[model samples]
Target chain A: MASYTERQAGSRLADYLSERAQVLSIALFFAICILFFSATTTTFLTTGNLLNVVRQAAPILIVAVAMTLVITTAGIDLSVGSLVALINALAAILMAAGLPWPVVVVLMLVAGGLIGGVQGWFISYQGIPAFIVTLAGLSILRGFALLLTEGYSIPIRDAAGFFWLGRGEVLGFPVPALLAILVAILGFIVMLHTQYGRQVVAVGSNMEAARRVGMPAKRVLASVYVVSGVASAIAGMLIAARLGSGSSNAAQGFELQVIAAVVLGGTSLMGGRASMTGTVLGTMTIAVIGNGLILMHISPFFTQIVTGTIILVAIWMNTRLFDRNWRFARRKPS
Target chain B: MMAAEAQATRGRGDAPLPPEPILRLRNIHKSFGSHEALRGVDLDIRPGECLGLIGDNAAGKSTLSKVISGTYIPDVGEIELNGRAVRFSTPSEARDLNIEMVYQDLSLCDHVDVVGNLFLGRELKRGPFLDQKRMLAQAETMLAALEIRIPRLTAKVEKLSGGQRQAIAIARAASFEPKILLMDEPTSALAVAEVEAVLGLINRVKARGVAVVLVTHRMQDLFRVCDRVAVMYEGTKVAERAIGETDLQELVDLIVGKGGH
Candidate 1:
């Protein structure tokens, strides 16, 4: 006998739209930013300027991709900026000490993973809140960089291979931009198709359930930090390569910008939801806004104010407006 | 009623003579600090039988089920599976032995799709990647076998109603071909039709020769699906009776500790 339930099947289209509502809204906002910038600024849409925006946004994109995984587990990594500065200084220092560029790169990535592993240990095994652990990491890491550099920028000379990583052009595109795109694509694939990605979402959605089902819940939680650490290390190396110098003051408040990009991309702060495509678009939107404002001759300080305002409004729209029975253009009665 | 009773008796007679239980628990005693949650309880579950576990709140009904499911380790107990003694330190170990429990929370991931949740921890993989195509195909067969209609497998669990969600949870547990399936209040949140569907699912699983433990406060369900009923009182099993030999009033009396003598 058939069941007498009142709830009937909804259309597949409605379900898809509901599931991807956040991503769609963020895409719309990003497009609006692009249109506004292209209309207002003379060189905003130029290929060269667009390339430059992506080139500069490359490091942020890499770190933001890893941060997406971290945040998807309902965890935050505030120490990412400080970790970048540390690795930047360390890579430059190691390179200046006559170590081969390749060796230095390997060492920095390992160091990043180790540092993240330690933080993850405290957060996962020790039951420390991720926010608190990363907040402390933000302080200790920056302190280490400050102490190492003694408040001075260290110049990196004679690293031709390293410089190419940040400055070289490939097929008319900046190498860093290409690399960031590759990383974004990898992030998208991993989050959607990999077992590791499913585990991450499961842990975020219901940690106890994941554990009950025999998933290595704590290890998954801890490993995400390691990923963020390695990504930050790579970003740090990229910055050092680009500038030919490493400074203790590099990437100040960089974590905020990266996080803003992620949250604005519709990755839920509460965890269990993430969008790699949205993160990519969110990063570009921020970059374009910063570039366009400067081109419009607005003071850089005012740009910060505007960026902060936009981030606030975008997130406000994300949590408040999008969550409350809002659907994009309801289907009319036939 | 006579024909139904004759059929149940014939089914019992057709089973292995003096049938060995698929699962056996002896003197299961558990304590949480000063509180004694279970006091030397014993139970034997045979294949193709639904054992209804019922009692008032804090009567150790849930605690006994948890002990069996390995969610809680009893301080002292002897457990055997098909004549082999076994000890479980974790729920996973019990799961490895083909023992599955549908927890009170249902334990479905709100963010993941129906297919993902169905294969939650035991996902199929191909070289570090989820084998999505194969998993989708297998999930189709699994749901089809259980007579579950999800409408869209890609839809997240949170979007489904309580009835559909309950069915999915049961479908997940039953699809694993478990020998012992423990359901803790599976229909406490469902409407009448949904309750009927879950009861039907229980009958189907029972027909498959799996040892079913249905824990609930809904006494009416026991007559429909349970071959026998066990009553718990204050951390101990107070009574067990064949479904045909008992009535709702007797079960209520046993649970309330007033009339069964």
Candidate 2:
């Protein structure tokens, strides 16, 4: 009887490393950044500074978590930044109009979802490329924000409860930071343990295969955008609450930072592979770099150059050195 | 002989018999714009039987299989499953009726792990979460039942070899306990020993009384596992023969449109 010879299982340690190559590399890079910053600046390692970093990274982290889902489905939402600006502007306008803060928050979230749904419909049902649809959204949404605010920042007043969401501390941790952490944990659970997460990966990996196997592929594709939109709304609200005002210019170039953070975390732009842990690390690393550069007495404008370089290098190593197929040593034939 | 009687009654308006066909296709016709992919094809699939479908490229073998699997709706035809006429508008409808197809490309998500792919669309979930522990245990048994050995069930599909991937695809389809399983060139990418394993797997599946339609160019494989064979030429079934009644030369001629029809 003809039989298939079973391949000998390789070393367990090797298998573990290869599978986690991207996450490990990013984590290592994150550690190195932390070490460099601490050694160079006496104040960089302080709890106050570290907490401040997380607090500042909060909005970007929130949106990056959602962007992870978007990228996992092989889709990108270029409109997130614009959507954030629009929501940010709208929240202040609504509050100034004397609408209750809670009601405004809910309305903004719903508005965000509706806007995202429209874009998702075009991409999924209408068969338009997400890049085109979201690009158009980026322009149109930001334009709407500019039109609404008339190129001016709107001040929010008498909304202490709403402000608390952004500025309050819980158990000695910043509220925004805690919320960001909670969002990250939820995103991680959804991506790893939930049926919806499986559907996203499956649809991203092979739409036809997922469809053949009776998955709601188009629906899954569309839902990720809605997720991104909602996350952006939250981030927008938090920003408004933090500074006690909103502007059409809020979160400018925010989409790039969110995308950079997601990609930096080892989520493939091609889709079907995602790591929430990597995204968290990636977001924190960027935040730390931006923060650490100032402490080192470096010019603030130079931060962009450094951030861009790190993105390029990290992705370079992601594709080359730490590929899932890369092995530390060759296995000898038994 | 039993094969002679079965052949004599085929396409002659049903035979009164002890073993009724599980699936019956009558006058199936499909077209793609200016191309007629399938023209008036009739076939029957009996339970516990393996039917070999052989033809050259563009011979409508794939189209016919797709029709059976509900990937494409036939322009005109009748599909009878368990004596009830049915029309399938989508693959899921056919899957709901326990019809499964393993395509030539294997149709697996490379980014998903082995256990996940095995239960791709029909995931075993508990309260909105994928029941990973349960799925892993079941996936292990599923592979073990097919005598397939994978180093780890958690390994991503992309990490697997061609033969291993093929085995996983076949395992995914067969383990689903479908009433009818259609395979399109499943063994084409497999190694020689892996081919044997697939053939052995087919026999095991056939023993479970599932109707299997295997479309392949491997003539020798037909003799090994198929109880009967059908030949197609230019979108029409030209001939059908029981395993004992046909030779490799006859099948080759039939596929190439050389034998006297």
TM-score of 1: 0.93
- Residue-wise lDDT of candidate 1 within B1-261, one digit each (tens)? 554476457656766363578999999999999999999999999888889999999999888888888888889989999999999877788988999988888888888989999999999999888998898899999888766677888877887888778878888888898999999999988878678878888888888888999999988788788888999999999999887777788899999999555
Per-residue alpha-carbon lDDT of model 2 for A165-201, expressed as tens digits? 8889998899999999999999999999999999999
TM-scores of the candidates in the order shown = 0.93, 0.93
The docking category that best describes candidate 1 is medium
Off by over 4 Å in 1: A1-9, A324-334, B1-12, B15-18, B31-35, B191-193, B259-261
lDDT of 1 at A27: 86
Q: Residue A198 lDDT in model 1?
A: 97
RMSD of every candidate to native, in Å, equals 3.3, 3.9
lDDT of 1 by residue, A1-334 (tens): 9887668777777767877777887788888988998899899899989889999999999999999999999999999999999999999888888999999999999999999999999999999999999999999999999999998999999889899998999888898888899999999999999989999999998998887787889999999999999999999999998999998889888898899899888887788888899899888888888888898888877767766886798668766666622344444599
Evaluate residue A3 in candidate 1 and report its C-alpha lDDT on the 0 to 100 scale.
Answer: 83
Model 2, first chain, TM-score of 0.94
